[model samples]
Target: MGCSHLVIQRDFAAFFLHFFYQSWMLYPENESTIVSWIWIGIGILFLTTAFIILLVTHYFEQIRKNKRKMIQLVRNAETECWESIHYLQERDRERLSEELHDNIISQLNIIRLNINTRNGKELNSDLKRSMQLVRELSHNLTPPDLNGIELSDFISDYLVQISKEVEVLYVNHTEQDILISGTIKLNLFRIVQELITNILKHAFATEITVLLRVSVKYLSLVVKDNGRGFPMEKYNKGIGMKNIQSRSRKINAVYKFKTKPEKGTRCIVFLTLNNTKI
Candidate 1:
């Protein structure tokens, strides 16, 4: 904007200089009255000022149009992300249905048979497994804590649910538990979930580390994996990353990713905590 303004001023300066020269040439040196020259000068000045104002206004309008265009692009991207999120929700429902029928129902039926046969040990074993399955399903539906307190513990619990397949470690560095709004907590949870899902699905890494830090003024989350990192330009444009981007913006957070092929990846999220409940 500044460059455009400067160029306009420079061009206008030259154009006005030539215009005044031509106007001066219109009158002979002695024949031109002082009042007439003054009038001519005032007219030139007025036109120059008006043209500058017009240029400034035009530049401002262009800026507004660009801003609107950018907002529309974001809206379109977010709309696409919601479609992906909905697809994920549908898949979760299908998986839950299958687990209920194939695992819990079948296990319960076996326990019933064992009880009928007076098999106490077998019945106890089946009951334990059934309880575990139910707990897992419950966790999948809702996070461990709904109040948005104890975010580290919530993340720890989530990791537990997925740790059996791969090694996962979590560390909390905050001196006190952080109380965040439900909106922040839920978005962070989804972001964390998406990062881990990507690692598990594609990274093939056996070690995952999550670090949580909350201070009086700000909070940060770090998720790192020792898996094969992806190309920044290629893989970072996926719906998962775009979803994270939108969520980051919604919460006024900064989301950054550092990665390289075979070098592993680290994701960082930082946000101010001024609005957070103590």
Candidate 2:
């Protein structure tokens, strides 16, 4: 074993000795080519570093431009949002004024007339009617208490009131009181209210059907009416329609209207509560 180990060491030493000798013989011949190749490599390294620096500069510059663009977009969006809020406020005030003038004030004027004519019975009836009108107006203004009831029940209750005037159907495909955030539910309720109001006022239809469907990912509310339909493009210009649009936006919902001249109208709103973006 010792003799074989010695033989292996001798073989390695001889091999290295021959290698150095051959390199020493070749060095002078290859010296200029080797030096030229080294300089070329150094130049390549410098060029690569300069190219990398340029690329990094351009990348950072692009990032800055994108950031500026994003900030400007945000500013524009904030201005638009404020404008929308003011417009909606003004519209709501106008609507309330119109309702007061058209309903209770007119009724009071009639009561005053009855009193002047010395008609006690008619005055009493007019007073009662005015009281009922006031009650209805107050009810419309006050937001419903949603802490105890589910969103479906609140909508269903509204449909029941509307059913007295029009044929109404309410269908819930999910649990009656499914777990949902209060803000999300409130926005949804407002959307439903707006849709029903629009349908009652504009759709001279005989029947209306409301469907609420919930899934793991999202929920959809659909209102369909069998009334004379108006073009959605034109109707969307109205204040009521704008209100619905705004509410849909708040809840990150998508709404579409389907209607023809004589055909009934179907309004669908889809909302995604699970999205953190909302």
Candidate 3:
């Protein structure tokens, strides 16, 4: 490398001297002064060209760096905003859970006891059904036990419970020991929840399926529904879909979807456990 650089410098110097000699020879009568001005002009042009190139390169680099930073900043802001929203939702759910457990459940029990004593069996049965609905609502807000639980198991149980409302089928090809960081797990779980919620809200289908598969390099989850699907271009570009995409991107996961009207909607989420740039 040193020898190559030395040779480059030598060649440049020889070219410079040759160019100067020729320019001076063209104006040999007053060659010295004219040659000086020509050399100065040549030098200025070289410096100006160098400066322009450097400015352009610097501007391009700055633009690239600013674009990257802006993207990162927007993503971070999105994450924080979602977190705050989740926190608020959880807070509201917690409050609702407490009200259900404390006020509504207690009042329903009292009503049940009062009716059991005063009214016939029909009234008591009605009270029991109302109490049951309250209990279901409470459970839906906050999971009973999640501490030290594997997310796969938690999700499995969740789907089974959801299956009671609408059919849910789980196809598992995962090795079962693929544990992830808590934050990653949380984000993924929320994504699953969001997809499931979307299906419940929109898909008037009889059955939905969630598939999990994992390999040494990647973990993938596929959620599909046998519903009256929407136009692929329409729904996939909707707000909910965009939100899912954003959350998936935060975890460096690849998100894809396939859908056909009157057919079904299928979403594939793939994540790498290691911090490998996508």
Using TM-score as the yardstick, the better of models 1 and 2 is: 2
**Candidates 2 and 3 compared by TM-score, better number:** 2
User: Relative to the true structure, how large is the alpha-carbon lDDT of every model?
Assistant: 0.74, 0.71, 0.68
What is the overall TM-score of model 3 with all chains considered together?
A: 0.46
- For candidate 2, the per-residue lDDT at 216 reads 55
Which portions of model 3 miss their true places by more than 4 Å? 1-147, 275-278
Model 2 bad stretches (over 4 Å): 1-144, 275-278
Best-fitting candidate, scored by TM-score: 2
Cand. 1 TM to true fold:
0.49
lDDT of 1 by residue, 110-196 (tens): 455336554577568668978987998787644234584677777787677456557888888875645677777767876787777
Query: What value of lDDT does candidate 2 attain over all alpha carbons?
Result: 0.71
The number of the candidate with the highest lDDT is 1
- Model 1 misplacement above 4 A: 1-145, 275-277
TM-score of each: 0.49, 0.50, 0.46
Report how far off residue 70 is in candidate 2 (Å).
Answer: 26
